[model samples]
Target chain A: MRKFFVLLAGMVLFLASSLTFIYVKGENDSVNDLLSANVDALADNESSGGLDANYHRIDSKCEVFVSAGMQIDIFGIGIITAKADGKIAIDGKVVCQSKGNETCRPVECSDLYSVILHGGER
Target chain B: MRKFPYFSFVLSLVVISCVSQTKNEPNVQGISVDINKQADISEFVSSFDGYVCLETYEECLVNEIRKLKMVGDTIYVADDTKITMFSRRDGSYLGKIHKHGRGPGEYITLTDFDVFDSRLYVLSNVDREIIMYNASGDVLRIINTGEGFSNLSVIDEDNIWLYSSDSNDSMYNFILIGPDADVKAKYDKFSKNQSYTIEDITFCGSVSDTLYVSQYYDNIVYSLHYDGYVPLYRFDMNLRNTVSQEELSATPLSELHKTYKYKESFRSIMHIDRNRHTLFAETWCFLDGLALKTCFVKADMVTGKSHFYICGYDVDERFPLFDLSDVIGYDGKVLISYLTAFSAKKHGKKYKIGNLADISEYDNPVIVFHTLNY
Candidate 1:
């Protein structure tokens, strides 16, 4: 009886561990999918190119590559790729790749991030 | 021992199911407002008579009038950068209260301001301080509210109520501060753990002794009392067609616009006047395409006889002088400001504002005050 009880306890622990692992892995996968989907949506925009003189609208049919220390305002739907050494500014503040260095920071402003994520739907 | 594992698993499943069921249910309960029909402005507003014209060309060059409040004859106006005082009787500039610097008694960004008892309280976003000034534009005393607050309103001479974005586990959305800048109370009557973005849709207004607060996403409007926040009214604009918060969160940020492209969303409660028992709100609904539908709701608190008017007309058809951008309630009157140039050219003959041929596009706005018929 003692041996049977010990076996049951071990099985229960293993099952719980497996369930937790699966749940966590599933959550992580969903998060990655969300982020990748956002990136693809932004890249799908046709108007992506060098900084337009208008300062508001960047008119281009190709991918807009922003180098470090360059400030560009994106209007409508435009995909921007920041170089490893390039930085980008959004809404008057330097956001990504500042000072010739790439720093990863979480975007706090939901409205600003929504504009970037949605490719300027508004 | 063998049955113990099976029993525990069954119990856990029951608990999980109960929790999920409770979460899916609507947590709020209050009066419902169903917008079944639309009415013209004249049908609901009784009359749309203009009381004052604020066209102080250069004296009060309001670059962008963010907020306006009238106390007696002093009209406090918060423009894009600074707060300017003007005479309500005449469109003359009284004085300006812009100490734009990083020094003491100065502010980097003027977020909001309120005038009470001849004292002006200016809340600076960057400085995280409430700079108080007397009627003469002299700095009184600065109250440093250690953290950044999004909105503020003076409850009385000694107490100030402020809204701060809280990501912490705390459920409170507002903090009442004393004269010495000490937190007097923290109160909220809603489900906790709401996203930080909810703050953008939150607005607070006080009329008489009751403090009215509401989140645009939520249908309920809460009034802060001495005890706590009580659900005063609920607006049911038929948001059943809108995207649920659960679905919104599950969807990717990038796909939000596409998935909910045609979904109608409740934007914000623009103005609330308790004395007149009136509330104005702006909602975004897809009409031909995306468009704003302004709702002017009036409810009799005692009788509960409510009526709403939907102001969704072209610039020419609607009251040309009243833009839904900003509405202020003061001294039992509703004040609306319009860009004089736009109104003058759009419906010059219809509205009958004399000779705007010389009014440039850069001129100050024309303030229109309308008396509410109770």
Candidate 2:
């Protein structure tokens, strides 16, 4: 009788250990999958020229950094920061900058006029 | 098993909450004006008389006219580059206001201009400034209006009304600025949906002291008082067939054409005659889902009668009765100009009242005056 009781307790302990092991393994796999997904998202944000990560606008102060091609318009009496090589139109004039050419300046009127008057030609 | 049921119940509750969140929006009401019948242009316009011919002269030859305003005896004609002044009595070239440069007083692109109390206000899109000039084309003042202003109208010597296409959190559609470019007041009467590509569709004009404002989508015409805007009139445009803002937000922009297959809308109110209680507008809509048609509309505010007329000229017709242009109201009269050498030349003899024969290919447009028949 004593041997049977000891054997029964040992079986119960073994079953509990097996169930705990399965649950722990399943929990670890889920955690690992979540970590991997987060890492991929961070990688994407970095590869996209940090556009989504570093967009900010305060009053008239705006900073936009895009990796791919984009057409952006900045208005109001404010400073604007854009990525180099991006086409930025401020007050209808297109300004294309090179890499690391982030500068905040007010939009100045272009020297060229859109329509030429025939008064001089005539 | 217990956890499974609980999770399923929570998921179903979330779905139900989301489904119930989309409330049914009420349909906006507007005054519907029937535009199915065609009308005779002569019935609306009492007479199409020769007002003032802006003769294409050497000193004032305009390539493309952007805006026109008549202040007293001077006719202010603004092309894309310069604002050329001409005498309204004899079509004599006075002087040209072409400050085209990168200087402090120069402008890159002339978006719009207005004349009030003998002062000409030229709004530059690139410079974002209003170069105020006297009647003789002399620069009186240079008002720096920040940037992105699409149109402007000089209310008085001390004040001017400006319109911007872009709307920020604080500023809305219109802004009232002083002569020093200081923002006196900003009005936010309209909502920005960001659905349409063309944002500068708001038409603003003033009859004496009362300023009128209207948009392409909204049928209500608003009047600016001290600080608020009051609805003066509403046109029933039958916008039921138009696309709703909810649908616009749901559909991807790429698939917009598939969802809203047809686009029907009114153009900006070009001319509003207060004396005759009449307004003129243009309509652009898909015809039979095949081609786009441009139709002209005239509505009488007193009787609520509106007429839609097709713009064209028959070969045998002597005078082409209807041709829509950028119209402006002045002193109880509405003025519409036509390129006599190009479009109006095809319309036979009666339309050739102006100096059409002398007008060259690159000459300025000829002006036509019409009095509203009440």
Regions of candidate 1 where Cα sits further than 4 Å from its true position: A1-122, B1-36, B55-59, B167-171, B189-204, B243-262, B274-290, B299-306, B315-320, B323-331, B355-358
Model 2 agreement with the true structure over B125-223: per-residue lDDT tens digits: 556689988866678999988744666777788888777643222245678888788878777534432211232334455666668776443445677
Task: Estimate how well candidate 2 is docked, as a DockQ score.
Answer: 0.01
**Which window of 10 residues has the lowest lDDT sum in candidate 2 chain B?**
B192-201
Fnat for each predicted structure, in order: 0.00, 0.00
Clashing pairs in 2: B31-B236, B32-B236
* Worst 10 contiguous positions by lDDT, candidate 1 chain B: B283-292
Error of 1 at B54 (Å): 3.2
lDDT of each: 0.55, 0.54
Candidate 2 on A1-122: residue-level lDDT in tens?
A: 99999999999999999999999999999999999999988888778755432111111111222212222323322222222211122212223211111222222333212222111110
Q: Write the per-residue lDDT of candidate 1 for residues B169-266, one digit (tens) a residue.
A: 33456778887888888885234332222223245456576787765344456777556766655555654355455654455322444443334554
